[model samples]
Each structure stands twice: as C-alpha cells, then as structure tokens.
Target: MIKKIFLAIIILISLTNSVNASTTSNYAEPVQTISKTYTEGFYKFDNKNDVDIGVTLITNTPTKIMILDENMNVQFISLIPYNTKFYLRNIAPKKIIAIIGDGEVALSFDKI
Candidate 1:
C-alpha cells in the first residue's frame, strides 16, 4: 500500500509539471515593455530591432509622428489627425527612436 501511494504521488507530480509546461508553451511569450506617459506634449518610443512598435494617439489632438533609427535617420513619418483613433501596423523595427509631435500618446511594441 505504501509503495503504491508513493508511486501515485510521483505520477501525479509528473503529470502536473507536464500540464504546466504545455500551458506555458501554448501562449506567445510576452516581451518586456516600458510604458510611459509623455505629457510634455511630445513622446518617443525606443524601438527594438526586429520588433515592430505600435503607436496610438490617445488624445484628440492633431499630431505628427516620425520613426527614426539608432543614428537619428528617419525611417517613416505620418500625421494623425484630431479625433481619430490612429494605429500604425507592421512598421519595421528601428534601431533608435520614434518621435511624436506635440501630443499625448499610448504606445506598445508590436510582435514581428
């Protein structure tokens, strides 16, 4: 009886670990993000190479955005009109920074 109970416990622990591993693997791994509010009427998101960044203007203000590389070279630029829910998709990750022109914004890193 004692041997059977010990064996059962071992099997249970193994099954638990397997289940946990599968559950963890079934989901996409989350990336670390630095979320901040740039209410200074300007914003910048440091884009990581190979990881696209998403920029959404949260306020009803006409704003222009620019994407730059690590060396301050411009990669892409756009303007978000007022009262519009702006979204940028599939933008290639840059080496340096992204800039917002005079607006409050919510930003995130998009999966590549």
Candidate 2:
C-alpha cells in the first residue's frame, strides 16, 4: 500500500509539471513583410492580432511613422532619415501609418 501511494504521488507531480511546461512555452507567429513605394502621402495597415508585435521599417527617403489606437490617438511615432533602417519591438497597436513629406519613398514593414 505504501509503495502504491508513493508511485501515485510521483506520477501526479510529473503530470502537473509537464502540463505547466507546455502552457508556459512561448509561441510566436511567423514574420510578415509589406513593402511599398509612395509619393507625398500616407499608408495605413491593420493590426489583426492584439499581441505584441515587432516592426522593422526600412526607408529610402525621410519618413514619418505613426502607430495609433482605435480612437486615432497616436501611441508611437518616429522620424526616420533617408537611407536608414528603423525597428520597433513589443508594440501592440490598432493601426500603423507612414507619411512622406515630399518626393517618393520606398519602405518596408516586417511584422513579427
């Protein structure tokens, strides 16, 4: 009876540990990239998932990037210079928009 009880407890503990390990593991979606060229205007993108995402912005000309919430409030903004690369990590926003003041610009967005 004693050996049976000890074996049962060990099995229960192992099962609990395995369950926790599986649940605590982190799983992220595959990276998605969007590239475009635009004149003196803005482009918007929808953020389907509310989870934190990483953004990589590459621009050929000076540009402005803004992340807004559902109410159109700016959550994040940055000015990237010509021929530069920018990165934003762990940001969860409702929308993303990029603006160009003058001339044409080439940019790309990497969602991770």
Candidate 3:
C-alpha cells in the first residue's frame, strides 16, 4: 500500500512539473493578413537629384525600393525599412510622393 501511494504521488509530481515546464502564452490568436491597396506617384527631393515614387513594400523581406529613371530603367535600389523615407540621389526631373500605411495613405510634398 505504501509503495503504491508513493508511486502515485511521484507520477502526479512528474505530471505537474511537465505541465509547468511549458512556457507558451495563453493569449489571443494571431492576426490574419489581408491584401491592401497602395498609391504611388512622382516625388522630388531638395538635396538629391532624383524623381522618386514611394510605395508600400514589405519590411526586411526580399523586396526593395526601386528607383527608376524617366525611361523606366532601374536607377537605384534602397533597402529601407517599412514606413521609412529615403532620398534618391543623382537623377533628373524629380518629385516626391509618399504612399504609406496598411490603409494606403497618400502624402505629397511640394518640395523635397
């Protein structure tokens, strides 16, 4: 009888320790991702000489901010983070249009 009780207590303690060892959080479920639309347009900077069109790009992904010339050639690529502003250097007839946020916000700067 003594051995049986001791074995049962040991099993309960082991189960309790196993349950306590798990460190997962009992929180809400993860958020779902959905497709969002964004607007992009021409932008000019003061200190730089490139026309830029800003767009919503995935942060830290394989994606990059592409700079194009008037002839639609790839001029430069900026590895900026999400919601970051960058000035493209050394180009012609430039303007600055900011398209940002998950909700597709548009901002226009008259100069720079």
Model 3 ranges off by over 4 Å: 1-62, 89-91, 94-107, 110-112
The model with the greatest TM-score is 1
lDDT of each: 0.49, 0.46, 0.36
What's each prediction's clash count? 2, 0, 6
- Cα lDDT tens digits for candidate 3, 1-112: 5575457445534643454455742111121122233333223234233333334454434223444333333455443455554443334443222222223322222233
Q: List the lowest-lDDT window of 10 residues for candidate 3.
A: 25-34
Ranking by TM-score: 1, 2, 3
The TM-score values for the models, in the order shown, are 0.48, 0.45, 0.30
- Rate residue 61 of model 3 by lDDT: 41
Q: Taking the tens digit of each residue's C-alpha lDDT, what string does model 2 give over 16-94?
A: 3454356442111122334555554323444454434333334455445555443344566565566645555545544
User: Which residue pairs in candidate 1 collide?
Assistant: 69-96, 70-96
Q: Which residue pairs overlap in candidate 3's backbone?
A: 43-95, 43-96, 44-95, 44-96, 49-91, 51-94
lDDT value for model 1 = 0.49
Show the colliding residue pairs in model 2: none
C-alpha RMSD for every candidate? 19.5, 20.5, 23.2
Question: How should the candidates be ordered by lDDT, best one leading?
Answer: 1, 2, 3
Residue 52 CA displacement from its true place in model 3, Å: 7.4
Best-matching candidate per lDDT? 1
